[model samples]
Target: MEVNVIFSAILIFIIVYLLFSLSGILFPIDRTWYASLKKPSWTPSGKTIGIIWAILYALIALSLAIVEYKIGLKNTSITFMLLWVINYLANQAFSFFEFKAKRLDLAFLDTAVVAITTLLLIFATLQYSVLAAILLIPYLIWSTIATLLAWSIYRLNK
Candidate 1:
């Protein structure tokens, strides 16, 4: 890709991902069922997850910036970044849809989509840059645990 285009894509990815998070800034508190759920002992507190996610998202954005500046935006790299961002956004959307819209089924599906897309991002990342792939490891791991959490919530509240 052209250098300018690559940089543009990177900027767009970061901005879009930030917007996605902002769109659901109140998700944790607004989720009524989330507050009521019997969380697992392994579940991290909302504050902890928030801190982790904030750091992770910032890392992801910076990592992509590194790629854009250093590597000039390979197609594989751009694909990995976009897929990762999309899945992350989708994951947040589930919380809003489930608690606010009261659509457990749709929320379940959205969570499943996030999990699947996360896997895709991991795969795409692994194909080229180890740094990119490594950056997504926590995201993949979290999504796996989140899938289980979502399923548990659906079963418990259904």
Candidate 2:
């Protein structure tokens, strides 16, 4: 990869992860509130969630970098940009609804949007970069799992 490409990837990684970190900070996970909820047995541990999100964010950054290199940012379609924006907003909304607002139902809906946008992102990126599309598969799968987990929690609690 060219130096510029590597830098672009690094920058994307930093920006994406920083946004996620900021969301977490704003929500500030309420461990006491979460523990009081009726989560499913399959729910992952806190450490596991952290590790998985870190990897997923890295993959997302790499995928975006590949897309940027294959099709210059200026050339990306408006639909693609809209999907990315929706995905980011939906992802952030989950944290706000679940941790900050303590609304599991809304959080579940937010996660559903995240999963759908991730799927759309995969198909949208496929047009410009096969590698980028492939890289997003894990994120799509993870988002699906998260949506299901959120639903499970909502069902159990409600």
TM-score for every candidate vs. truth? Answer: 0.73, 0.93
As a TM-score, model 1 comes out at 0.73
* Cα error, candidate 1, residue 22 (Å): 2.3
Whole-model lDDT for model 1 versus the true structure?
A: 0.69
What are the clashing pairs of model 1?
Answer: none
Q: Residues 36-103, candidate 1: write the lDDT tens digits.
A: 77666677787887787777676666555555555545554567668866876796787687767767
Q: Compare the candidates by TM-score and give the number of the best one.
A: 2
lDDT for model 2? 0.87
Residue-level error in angstroms, candidate 2, position 56? 0.4
- Please give, for residues 3-60, the per-residue lDDT of candidate 2 as tens digits: 7876776677678767766677777789999999999999999889989988888888
